[model samples]
Target: MGVDRSMWKMNPERLQEHLQLKNRARQIPDKKKESKKRACRVSRRALPLFPSLSV
Candidate 1:
């Protein structure tokens, strides 16, 4: 039987480019990481303004 080249939905070169783009995106830090650092900082700033709540 002949190989079914149409079985591949994407062209091989385009598929490789798409995968590389995905890997590049994975290296960037997203908003969740930034917001987590900001959240931890909130208590430090809040504690100064609300001294009674800090107890």
Candidate 2:
């Protein structure tokens, strides 16, 4: 089987740009995780404010 030459048309610089964008997308959840940790830490003090609903 012959290799496809069409896939190699991308410029090296463009490939690097795409890779950097993908890496930044991967790091987004990490920031959210840190915020969630802070929220959980503060939530304990606020939990009692919401009264439990009886069915």
Candidate 3:
């Protein structure tokens, strides 16, 4: 279960794009975590001002 390197060499630009995509994919989890943290902070701040809306 390995990629064929020869096929990658046929188009360096495509390979570079693929590598960049892979790198971005790896950063997705961290990005999601940061987004969730920001969302939590926002929700917490809003909650205090909207206590009457809560059941």
Better of 1 and 2 by TM-score: 1
Candidate 3 regions exceeding 4 Å error are: 1-10, 30-55
Candidate 1 residue pairs in backbone clash: none
Residues 1-55 of candidate 1 have per-residue lDDT tens digits of 6864654788889878877887899898899999999998996787687679878
Q: State every prediction's TM-score relative to the real structure.
A: 0.48, 0.38, 0.39
Worst 10 residues of 1 by lDDT: 1-10
TM-score of model 2 vs. true structure: 0.38
What C-alpha lDDT values do all the predictions have?
0.81, 0.76, 0.80
Model 2 error, position 18 (Å): 0.3
TM-score of 3: 0.39
Highest-scoring model, lDDT: 1
How big is the positional error of residue 22 in model 2, measured in Å on the Cα after superposition?
0.3
Task: Rank all candidate structures by their lDDT, best first, as comma-separated numbers.
Answer: 1, 3, 2
**Candidate 2 Cα RMSD after full superposition onto the native fold (Å):** 8.3
